[model samples]
Target: MEKLNWIAVDWGTSHLRVWLMDDQSKVLQHLASDRGMSSLKPEEYEATLIEMVGDALPDQGSIPVICCGMAGSRQGWAEAPYGKAPCTPPSIDAATRVSTKVSRISVFILPGIKQLPAADVMRGEETQIAGFLAENSDFDGVICLPGTHCKWVHISAGEVVSFRTFMTGELFALICGSSVLRHSVDDEGWDAEAFDAAVSDAISRPAAIAGNLFSIRAESLLSGLSAAAARSRISGLLIGIELAAARPYWLGQDVVIVGESGIASAYEVGLIQQGAMARRVTAENMTLNGLRAAHAKMVEIAQ
Candidate 1:
């Protein structure tokens, strides 16, 4: 326990990921919980950290805990003010230090990046971007992060040039689970052919989206479209529309899709279908790596 150098945390909306680390940046232990920022009160954050990592803390001394994500949001444990765009990822020195009741630990949360005029903001994804840039420092292109609100970020010279967000994922859930399309859609099965065709169709005729979504229900009722086709079509159409709007950001450029296999693959596949050079990379350990990068600077600054 005395060998513990510092701690790393990726605190997001729906989950909390912690890593116990030594000076070498190697993880000695890992822990997680569904107790995300959304579920925690500001006052409870200090106790929550102790409760989660008490077993692993060193017996006597205080340890630095570097964190990234919603935990630094205005409503989170501490409000880590956002750094404007056209800048590198937030560094450890810029982290917001949260005052704690426990002397055995200190918490520092990273700030996210915000773009002006567009009024766009990101929290947890910044960590992943930092991790990506750590390995591919010279990368200059677009990074597509797919989730409830998908984000398309432009990177150049190690800076977040600009970004835009889409609501395709959330829209998919709402239309398929709570809207009129519910009766026509199934969450399980997928039709690859239907999905591919829909992506192409939507990319070519984006304005058709308003009419196409409702067509899923009509097709299911009249033409007897299978539930699998309906579900896949909806997904393809929504993602396709996003690709259409984001075409200017991609087109002949190379794009890196950073996320889990499922959603990341969808973006890669969709972009490829549109003739864009797209590839998928798993998000495992990227957050931790990003935190490690920040912690490195933190250690140096402290010294």
Candidate 2:
């Protein structure tokens, strides 16, 4: 049996994921829960972690735990704080130590990155950026992290130089599920032709997005546009607007999209439509690789 030497955690606003890892960074077992930062009090974090992984924890010595994401937010277990940008992701020295009632557990939450002057902060994606840099040390370009709030980051010299956030995903959910468009969009299907056309239309005339949005409903009523197509257009239009605004980041630059959702694919397509070459990597794998990088650095510090 493989010995569990440590724990890797990614606790976000909506979910918590834990990985039991060996000394060599091989994952032994994994678990996830819906009890995220928004669901727990600061004092309840230790108990919640124990409830999820107590059976797998070693009986003798304390196992080191390295975590990233919203768990480091001010309202989380302990504020790991934010390290400034144009800098590497924070390591062991920047981690926040959490005192556990259980004797065999030692937890450290990694600090995230903050961009001054513009006032933008990222919690979990910085670790993934660290992981990407760990492998592609020579990479210098843009990385788009697609989620509730998509981030477009600039990387140079193994550091995050600058970044911007767009509320495309949240807006999609709001407009599709709760707005007037909700009556027209089924939000459960895809139409590649409709998607591409919408991307081209939005990119060419981004300022006309308001009228285009109403067209989704008008067309549905007047010409019987399908709900699935309406959903696709809505997604494409928002992402298209973001691309118009983020042209400086992705235009003529190597682009990598980090995420594991359909929305990520949509971003890829939107970029390709603008003649930009873009590739995607799964967020789960990137997060695990990032935790591995942090663990290696922390262990090195201990030595």
Candidate 2 — which pairs collide?
none
Where in model 2 is the C-alpha error above 4 Å? none
Output the lDDT of residue 163, model 2.
Answer: 91
What TM-score does model 1 achieve against the real structure? 0.94
Write candidate 2's Cα lDDT for 1-303 as tens digits: 599999999999889999999989999998999999989999999999999889888789999999999999999989998999978877767888988899899999999899998889999999999888888999999999999889999999988999998888899899998889999999488988888888888888999999999999999999999988999999888888889999999988999999986878999988988899999998888898889998999888879
Candidate 1 C-alpha lDDT tens digits along 60-163: 98999998989999999999999999888887878898899899998899999999989999987888899889988999999888988888999999999999
Q: Which regions in candidate 1 have their CA more than 4 angstroms from the true location?
A: 1-3
Candidate achieving the largest TM-score: 2
Least lDDT summed over 10 consecutive residues: which range in candidate 2?
86-95
Report lDDT (Cα) of residue 254, candidate 1: 72
- Clashes by residue pair, model 1: none
Q: What Cα-based lDDT does every candidate model obtain?
A: 0.88, 0.91
